[model samples]
Target: MSVQIQAEEQRYSRQQIRDLATELLINVGVREQFPTPLEEIIHYLGYTIEEFEPDDDTDRVSGAVNHRQQIIYINHQDAPRRQMFTLAHEIGHVFLHREQEANHIDYRDGAMTPREQEANHFAAELLMPENHFRHTWMTWEGEPELVAATYGVSAEAVRVRADILKLT
Candidate 1:
């Protein structure tokens, strides 16, 4: 189901989204885990996760969350690292955009709107908290591949996050 962002929906600053993600980590008691256990978080929030193969090969959809049913649906065909990011992105919708719609389906194509941008920020912060990411980057000698493995994210994700964190 396609979800629409409400015209009067509240928009959060990137910092606010990051803070929310951090708070969620602390609340879920996964703040110290190198690779955040997204499934655990989903369960803690009383949500179910299911994986399904897309009917269309060209479908750019990655994941979606149905707040009303408390389920997060992920593309089973994606790589493990991609699935992790998609799960975290869906969780971001649960926290930040659930009020705007019952179902939030994330498409990988097209330019992102403000809500999508916020969700992406939330996912990045959720998957790779700033302080831990910084420590890991230094410990790994600034190797994106190593950091990506450590964080269960893509190497590109690590690179982008490093750039965002201004980690030399």
Candidate 2:
């Protein structure tokens, strides 16, 4: 089943977004894996990923998604981890907001509307699934850096996930 069918409307609670992300991961055959294979998942969902260099070096734009064309564009200058997050974030937009907009762009400014928040939550859950992340957190003794490395995400991302998960 497509992620779109799982949602009856555009507005979703955090739990609903998490469930959608988890369901997508399982549908893509990505259970119990660190650094979820976003590329493969995108392909499975019939989307393409393309990287483009920004005209300005200081551009804060992270990525954009064109749902009509099924293409996701990421800033080539971003670190691999950032690109991964952006990719996941775009995928979240694809599944969650496709009906709301034909295209969506993301910025690194940290300003989040409700839809952006839902997309961020989906990205976190997709990349670091709660069950696997919790087990890894315990295995790593609650060290965000180690968990981040294992998950192929930034230490800050790990810390944020830990905070969201209440991992102490």
Candidate 3:
């Protein structure tokens, strides 16, 4: 059976979310860079990654710190690219939402919530910085793969950014 997935209505600009992510990382002492050392930064925030079997009903999930525990769980039964996005998404919860109160984010089937959308934007901006992505793409003489590689993201991501930039 085929399923329908809805494209989320964006509530924040790429610039706004990027700025918030930058501020969060800076407050945590993560130096400005491509693919910021998220694991390390999260560690400093007193969170750890744990593994569990996939729910079959869900792609991956994350657990936030609750009570006095300092651990978060991420399901590894996913593609490398998806695993990367999931991890970034969890980091999104850590910075953008109430971690101490919320315990889990079952980011299954690209779920949508206002908060999840915010996190998605944060992840996209963090993975693909707008200014850097634009500058790098401008240098690209029309090579999508080249630009995607330079930014360590998927070609589709670069393609979307290009569309957003009105480059193609």
Candidate 4:
């Protein structure tokens, strides 16, 4: 496909993933509930969540989902918020990209593949739906840290959510 076509396809894929995430959140009662029980949702979906240290020579792989094993492995070195977010991101891949063979996402601060971006969007929606996030952002005096603490997510996540909801 041409670059424009590829971009359009990716955009469509990401939107579908977002819709799925929203549905899952609502089905699990997390969309209306603060501090979404994301871990519980992951377990409810029958995926195993595990932690491990990355080998010294390789890059810091934040999370990986092996479809054959139905397992998610999160890096132990990351903060709690990142770990949880990584798990959500991996969950996104399994559910949203079911046709793909497999892919391990690197949680680095740089360019991301279209699939990686989709997973990130999935994670964000899973953790903080835009409507709920905006309500919380407005009611909580716009304190990202306070909202983050309430949601058990990183303040940066809240900031990004705020920006997404155009609160920033």
Measured by TM-score, how close is model 1 to the native structure?
0.90
lDDT string for model 4 (87-164, tens) is 878887777664564546555564687777788888888888777777788889999999998777999988887877
Candidate 2 vs candidate 4, TM-score winner: 2
Q: What is the lDDT of residue 156 in candidate 3?
A: 73
lDDT of 3 at 98: 45
59-156: candidate 3 lDDT, tens digit per residue: 44533333236566666666555555566667776666643234655556555778677776776666666677678777887588888666566677
The regions of model 1 sitting more than 4 angstroms off are 1-9
Q: Model 2 over residues 1-168: C-alpha lDDT tens digits? A: 456644434578878988898889889898667778998889998999989888775387899999999999999999999898889889998988888788988988857787888888889988898888999999999988899988888888888999988997
TM-score of 4: 0.84
Ranking by lDDT: 1, 2, 4, 3
**lDDT per residue as tens, model 1, 1-168:** 233434435689878987899999999999988689998899988899998888875368788888999999998889999999989988888888777787888878856888787878888999999888899999999999999999899999899899888885
Q: Any runs in candidate 2 off by more than 4 Å, and if so which?
A: 1-10
- The lDDT of each candidate is 0.87, 0.86, 0.64, 0.77
Report residue 150 deviation for candidate 2 (angstroms). Answer: 1.5
Alpha-carbon RMSD of each model: 3.2, 4.4, 7.0, 3.2
